[model samples]
Target: MSTRRKPQMHSSERARLDPFIVATGDASPRDQQDLMERPFFSLAKAKRVTPILYKAGYVQVEVYAVPEHGLATIWDADVLIWAASQIVEAENEGLRTSRFLRFTPYQMLSAIGRQTGSRDYKLLKGALTRLQATVIHTTIRNGENWRRHQFSWINEWEECVTRDGRVEGMEFVLPDWFYRGVIDRSLVLAIDRSYFKLTGGIERWLYRVARKHAGRQPSGWTFDIPHLHAKSGSQARVSDFALDIRRIAARQPLPGYRLDIEREGRRELLRIRPVKLSTESVGGTVGTLGTSGAGGIGTSGAAPSGLRAQDTQLTLWPETLIPGLNLESNLDSNFDVGPEDGGKPAPDGAASRSDTGRSEPVSPDDTRTREAQP
Candidate 1:
């Protein structure tokens, strides 16, 4: 009877694992939680090195930024991965990160800095080289879903031909876990182009500021520029400049704080509202500059006295996108009208052009008017 005994029965039967469940489980615990609700990069592991996924279209990448343990904001990548992890993870859950994540190098470059044939370019190349060395190869599809993955570092000054001028740029992705950890509370301040040019590279300067302010509670910082100017007049009176400074400061994440501006013999003070404004709030400030008595803000000191709210104009920085950082896309898609013959066939004995001038052929309206008179 023992030899002929049937297989023993079990109290519970094993169930087939749900692929969906397994898929969700694959992501790191820290990555599953909503990042917006809780700042990523606040965790202990994040405090050590972390990864960030930044994609600009078909181009997906993962980059690592090491937080100096509550000391400084230096995100030097130790590893770079192009797993398209977010997309892979999203597919498992029947979703995807926003389409904005797709590769759009032209757009990506517009955010970091303009393309210049200078040292800044060298720094960008160096950064790219460092990134290439760290990237690892991996795929995340299901059974029978094999796909090869690879990423080529963009060569410097390669033309990214958008409808607008071929802009220059680069981008790397950050891992989800890394996203939730270090860059959690990172506040993106859209530096107005005018402001950056005034200071010569505002984003770079702000990165330095953020690095300096890293790990500390947001409190106060001072701007001690030699050529600080206010919209009021050439003198750059503190009172005239105070409102704009305070307006700019108020948009920052810091709250319940007062900002005091001082230059030479002028000082003006303003307070940050308890509620922080989104980056768009800064855009509205441009409207204020045009309509408010701050009219002179953009007039280059010619129209200083025209201070009326109706005259407010939004003096936005040349739109810059910071991927996860900037809320505004800051994309410029205006069409430039070239000469009728495709740019004034060189000014070789041609008319003195006005502006980036290209002379257009005589208008049909003139011919029509001449015939109508007969």
Candidate 2:
């Protein structure tokens, strides 16, 4: 007693699947704008979420689409699988398009626990449980009629669950459209640990911003942050990176917003000050609520050429000091490889350290004591 309609595809129509691409080293100019406007991308139009997160010197980017409405775990998985399909399809197309093609594996593992809140890794895998795709080849007959080629290909993929080491890796073929999108040169803003602490749901928010402002450069933007901590053992405070931004924005319109510091009084204001924020810090906060109140303060900078680099640290309470603070990391204890095959992960085996494990955050209690210690 099932009531599901079968999916149908036309024979003559050229199959158009979602195109996915990945570019490393420098961000492309075309793609660079996407990174700057990352805070405004829309999930409704793309039916997917493209997230970019950085650790140390590396920046990772991923894109996936959801076909359902309402927030459900099932829908999350569906989108992931859909994106994986497009990645695979795009890769196959590359073999024909170029003589020497190259691609990077999509690190879906970093995205899984991140995309799904509450560490529900199983749900992510479940959504893609029964995914399938068809590869069709076609030919032209005598210039008048187009005849279907005799070859047809179908492939099935499964979620690679690794818990101890590295997560499962997927090789993505860079399609022309997707390739062009990602190849645009951009300034890879480096991020630090503090950036992660201040932002939640940051990855998703950044995807939207980048998508919407794909082509247009901002006039100027500001980092109007309140409760920004300093590394120099002073009271936390609010300050804008306007000075730094202005330096970056030689003469264009700024592209950021203002943040109001709560908690009352000029004394409190004096206690809390703003330190100049960086792209990594800004990007980290996209999907997350900031260290302070409800909405954080953002600033708009006058348009300028090449931003100048500055070194200033915001001193917020460490994660351990914050009571009941819900911090998420790329690592988690629940991660596991598919149906244990042996004791250790195989060199060529499915169980890799990256897949089986995740990053751990500092305990709030531990942080509290350290700050107060001595």
Candidate 3:
């Protein structure tokens, strides 16, 4: 796809700002909880012009994008995930951070588990363009005097090229809204690194939903099919959406979780239970993008359950719902505004594969044995 060329440096641009260089090291992937629960990006990889308008109680979000660049897809979100991981890693070591980031295309692609081919590099540029172009308006983090707050995922981005036109480095400025959310440890969660392996759009979104909602709760989390369908901002019909969800449940694709599709009278419910992975540790990195379509079971036999319009955000599933099932409790619900642990810091947990190392499927646990680099 053709993308706009970066503008030539003008006189005013002569005063260059120093960028935060992305260092080589393990960066335990983290995601902003605000971004995890909401529909901020298009689920489909195709150029989508449809605007997303999401509302739940006081929370409201609207996303708009230009046709040329299209709304950023969830796959594009790996870049943001990478950025969040970097900020958290830097802060953990007491290093300073800024929205301005500088790194090589290969460094990013490899870290995100994408091939470092020429095409992959081109695709990276496209993702950056879409991120910079997409505009978001939301009242999610706004206080009592809530009003329209608008911003793009990125303020701007550019490539540093040699005289021979070989791109050597890249730089981008992240918006303050996103930067603040990521910098604040309480607003982040250490997601399963295997999340990058799931190749479906709905599947990927569901994993984030799982990480955000389930956390390490013994009861895990339960959401009726339709409730999830709406929150997903999926374009699929309800029937199709439920079927896709059922497929994911059957596959049990989400790492560190066991999924069971159950029924309560006419209601079909999905219960996510935290399962123990033999080597599972809280971890992450990045991955390639995938696309998905949507529809719904809106008028399906049963009425939808649990719109969850209350302010407290409590999990109220009866204890007797499931009996005698052992569940593991190792992860944290960092997504919660205030976790019980007060959001203690963790070392960089990224598990990016080395170029010379043979690639193998990441275990559900994402087990790592080597000591973390300084």
Q: Is candidate 2 or candidate 3 better by TM-score?
A: 3
How big is the positional error of residue 44 in model 2, measured in Å on the Cα after superposition?
9.3
lDDT of 3 at 262: 77
Candidate ordering by TM-score (highest first) = 3, 2, 1
Task: List CA RMSD, all candidates.
Answer: 27.3, 23.7, 18.2
Number of the candidate with higher lDDT, 1 or 3: 3
Misplaced by over 4 Å in model 3 are 1-18, 278-374
Per-residue CA lDDT of candidate 1, range 204-296, in tens? 123223222211223333333322221011223455444545445544422222334444354332211112322221222211111101111
TM-score of each: 0.23, 0.25, 0.72
Query: lDDT tens string, model 2, 1-374?
Result: 22222112132111122112222222111122222222112212112322212211111122222233111121222232223223233333341111112121222322211332323334333323211121212221101232222211113222222354222322222222222222211211112222222222222232222222211222211111221112111121224332322222332111222222222343222111122333433432222111111112122111111112111111121223222311221112112222111122233222111111311121121111111100
Highest lDDT: which candidate? Answer: 3
- Looking at candidate 3, what is the lDDT of residue 361? 20
Clashes of 3: 15
Candidate that beats the other on lDDT, 2 or 3, i.e. the better one: 3
